[model samples]
Target: MTVRRPIQRFYTEPAPMNKLGKPHLQVVRSISVGQAPNIPDTDGVNEMLAKAGPSATLKDVARGILDRLVERPELEVQVEEILFLKDCLGASLEWLCSLAASDGAACFKRPLLWSGWCSRCDCEAKDYLMIYTKQVNANSCPGTPGSRSRTPSVAFSRPPSWESLDANILEDFDKWDFDSFQLSEATKGSPLHFAGWKALGGFLGEEPSDVFLEMERTSRFLEAVEDMYARQDTVLYHNNVHAADVTQCVHALLLQFGFAAYFDQLSILALLLGAIVHDMGHDGRTNSYHANVCDDIALTYNDISVLENMHISKTFKLMHSDPSTNILEGFKLEHRNRLRKEMVEVVLGTDMSSHFGNVADFKTLIEKLGSDPAEWHHEPKAMSALRVMVLHAMDISNPAKVLPLSDKWSDLLRQEFFLQGDEEKRLGLPISPLCDRETVRFASSQVGFFTIIVQPTFTLMAELQHRVKDVLLTHLQTNTEAWEARKRKEQLGLEISQALPLLKIRPLESTELTDLAVFPDTGACLFSPSRGGSTRDVPCDSQSHGQPRVPAVQRNVEDVEGSDDETALAALAALACCASVEAQVAKGFHKNRPAAPAEAFALFY
Candidate 1:
């Protein structure tokens, strides 16, 4: 008979052979120790043994390999674990664990764990690993790592507890100078993260533990926010600084009117988050520019609120891109859905095109709720409308800030507008209003923007938040006056340039001479001794003067040169009226009775 060695089958290493000539199943020794001894592979014998008894088969070996793989500390195992957890606990809890893992919390203490017995199993059991947090003045569990047996001897200053935040704190918000809260000084690189944490802790009355967890996700979310705004496409103005400014302003506004008390924690969260991300990934261009150029963003959003839609959608996409930054990680499915809806609404409301409609809605809500604070406190829809309005107000509040702050923001905004104008010129597109730096006066543009947009928006806001009326109106008036003063200064400079040639200090250049024909009555032929020019005179009533003639009124050259700016302006005004009268006489207007200088001055002024 031919002798053939028994095949090793699935085992990589050969099993030890017993004296009886049967192979010992070394891999299954622990599990099948109490089972029947291994038998030789014979057709009838194997079938009889398989039918007769339960044995460790190829299935047992495969199960053992899978269990070991799941427990291994490898990237593959981590990916598998994530998929498994996601399947077991659904997306929300899985997201929370993912963020916790990124924050080092899951590394030290497994985020998804259970120490209690399973009701279904009815036996003593442990699922995953338990987290043992260090506690002050608490005894350490014997086997727990990083547990404290005693409180720390050193005292530390902690943030105020939620219970300590009262009406007094809310009332004091109006006095707080928001400019003093610089993100560079306070948050290092994450102002929105800092603002979100403080707003939740101080205003929403969240516990320290809850705030700490929320901050983990907020920090992650802010990472994405920072990255998006740091891209090459991002411009100078609509960046992280602007987002932080709006967030801080929203927080202040919430406290200003006690909206914190009126809205729930979720609503407040949405409002603050909305402010922080309302302008996310702004390309420093307006929606009109996008639509006019048929840009991808405009086409995607159907050319309506293009930038706003892009900002909000990109924000949510970043929030889901990583587990670490998912701000709504642990929220219930319904709450998460609702928060997203509300946040999108609030962010979309920031579009300037929707500003008046949102303000009108808010005003109608306020009217329905009545002027009483008590009545306004309980209506959810009204409070939501107010929240949207508050965020919108904060978005546009930069121009209403104090002079120094507003001027800085205005300069940055003008630079951005000029850049767009440059792009438009390059593309042969019509330059947008207030975008052409060569033609548009910054101060005059600001005056129009303030009067047409900023003033009316804030006026409505002031009316709604009565306590902030004085503060808002004060800053609005101050900023408006500043812009108006700048406009007047600019206008005065232009008038001086136009009047310079009329003074006739020297012979007119070609451009100046051309300007002279338009002002026939103001074309004087007085020579300047200071300029070493010979004296000449011209009659004001002459239609054309080929040669200089003596004027009806003569003044000393020394007196004219020594006159103040006000005197020069007055002379220009008088000459302007004279030209107006000449033109009217030429047209047979007021022909019978020419108006006097005083009457013309009154009409012109």
Candidate 2:
């Protein structure tokens, strides 16, 4: 039977009830549209919003809906009702309706759900909706493009096989524009920016002119690094896109937390500029790669994380190569040294081997800051400590950002390292434990590395730098949990379970339309169901008007027939796992990629 799904669209509808029991009708639009007209352009919502004042519930709903969906459209499907409510009630209500709308707005709009309510409560339905909305928002936040739970890149093919995802990573490497980045984007001219801008102005000790120029210089450096980092072989699994993401995160932290006032323009510029270049010469091999076979780049830096340090120095040198591009040229000699030292400290801090000593020193400094908030001075040591802590945390911040993202990164790095180990085997070289191609359960060691090395380091730094406290703490908690959780899974033999396929997917790559996942356990290959199907088993039924519900059953390929049970189930499970992983990776990739016209969402019928 052909079932017509409601086409997501915008329309003028009856005003929803406001808190004041006032009549309000609003123009409701499905968020799938590419560009949203001004709320004022919507039928009657803006008129009341203006009359109600900015603090009015109607205003908040109108403003919040527009702001939330500006970057993400998938959210509309999840919160269509809330958007609809805002469209209708925002025009006439002043109190209860507004309050309910605000609660929904906050509950549904967070990046992730942090709490859950009792399942049996009368309001449980609303609570569950909120929880579900939180998950949807978290899974669908702006920074993470395709991640449902921040898993690494995975791929699925009609017949799955291993393929390198380097190209896919490169394509998405271009999307991040340094200058356009914001810490807290409330509205176009919101009070958030005004305060941040003022803080930055004060921090720089110069008015807008000099500070803006310095930012421009910083942006140029970031752009160049993006270009260089995107080249083949520079990044293996953790590539330029990862660099861009971390940079953006750091940039956002600086703006969001109002750190701009504490440090000077040189300091801010150094942190940002250094971030772009820090990983430029990374070869996917750990620092141990320094001791192996006199790597060409290693030879140049005398094996002291020479590649990273050189990346910093080379980036600056390149900047100075062209007079027009020379950001340091305009600075006074003392200022140049200050900028150089700050940049050096930040870039050098990326070395994971020295993370303990570095973060410890930073923690000591934070301890020294003590209870006096005003005693802070602009000393090189002070700036260096703060800058290093931020860059260091950023370098290792991936796992802490989200458990799935961290685990995925660890998986990819392990894969790439082992791939290198495979090359070693082919070349008659000794295989390293984590790096050896012959190694099975390679992820085991990475879990340890994350626990012992990566986790503690970032946790300490987060304690020191409040700017990324939320981001860092989240990562740390998630990292520990992921490790513990993965261990539990390993104990259950779930790690080796063939419930999911092992697909090698890349970020930001166009997937072939014909490829689909097939689960071996259930013999259920992916069938693109165009219409809603329901069963009594699901408590909250999303039922269509006239369709009869199908009874729940356990069968092999009953829905999509003509496929063998074992083969199809294996294929389906493998494909599903791969697809899940791929979707997560795609989000990160696209987020890092240069902005282009949005890719048309692929639909299955």
Candidate lDDT (C-alpha), each: 0.51, 0.44
TM-score result, candidate 1: 0.58
lDDT of 1: 0.51
TM-scores of the candidates are 0.58, 0.47
Across residues 471-498, which tens digit of lDDT does each residue of candidate 2 receive? 6666566677667654543432332243
Best by lDDT: 1
> How many residue pairs clash in model 1?
1
lDDT of 2 at 589: 31
Clashes per prediction?
1, 35
Best by TM-score: 1
